[model samples]
Target: MIRGVRGATTIEKDEPEIIFSEITKLVQEIVTANNIQPEDISSVVISTTTDIKSAFPAKAVRSLEGWQYVPTMCTHEIDVPGALPMCMRVLMHVNTEVHQKDIQHIYLNNAVSLRPDLVK
Candidate 1:
C-alpha cells in the first residue's frame, strides 16, 4: 500500500543555511517516525510559505545520504494573509503496508501549531 507521510517545520529566516538545515531535519524525522526507507519513498513534495525564498527545500532532501535518486519538487504555499510565515511543509509518498491511521505525521518548531491535532 502507498501511504502519505506528512510533516512541517519552520525556520526563523530565509537564509539558505537555515532553510537547508530545518528542511533536512523535517524530512529526516518523517522517515524515522514512519520507519520508511529512502527507496520506499515514491516522491516528496515540499511547499514553503512565500516569505521563504532563499532556497529550494528539495536541495536539502536530495543531498541526504542514499537519497540522491528520490524525486522531489519545491513550490510556494498559497499566500494567505496572516498565515504562518517561514513555514515549510512536506508530503512524502511512500510504499508501505502501514495503515493510514497508524502513520505518523510530524510537525516541529513553530509549524507545530499548523496541525496540533496531528501532533502527539
Candidate 2:
C-alpha cells in the first residue's frame, strides 16, 4: 500500500541554513519513525508559509544520501490570517505495508502545536 506521511516544522528565521537544517530534521524524523527507506519513497511535496523564502526545502530533501532520484516539489502554502509563520510542511508518499493508523506523522519545533492531537 502507498501511505502518505505528513510532517511540519517551524524555523526561527528565514535564513537558508535554518530552513535547510529544520527541514532536514523534519524529514529525517519522519523516515526514522516510520522505518522507511529512501528508495521506498515515491515522492515528497513540501510547502512553506509566505514568510519563508530564503531557500527551497526540496534542495535539502534531494541532498539526502540515496535520495538522489526521489521526486520532490516545493510550493508556498495557502496563507491564512493568524496562521503560523516560518512553517514548512511535507507530505511524503511512500510504498509501505504499514497501515494508515500506524504511520507516524512528524511535527517538530513550533509546528507541534499545529497538530497537537497527532503528536505522540
Question: What total of clashing residue pairs does each candidate reach?
Answer: 0, 0
- What tens-digit string does per-residue lDDT give for candidate 1 at 60-110? 899999999999999999999999999999999999999999999999999
Clashes of 1: 0
C-alpha RMSD values across all candidates: 0.6, 0.5
TM-score of 1: 0.98
Cα TM-score of candidate 2: 0.98
Q: Provide the lowest-lDDT 10-residue window in model 1.
A: 1-10
- lDDT for position 102 in model 1: 96
- Best prediction by lDDT: 2
- Model 2: per-residue Cα lDDT over 6-110, one tens digit each: 999999989999999999999999999999999999999999999999889999999999989999999999999999999999999999999999999999999
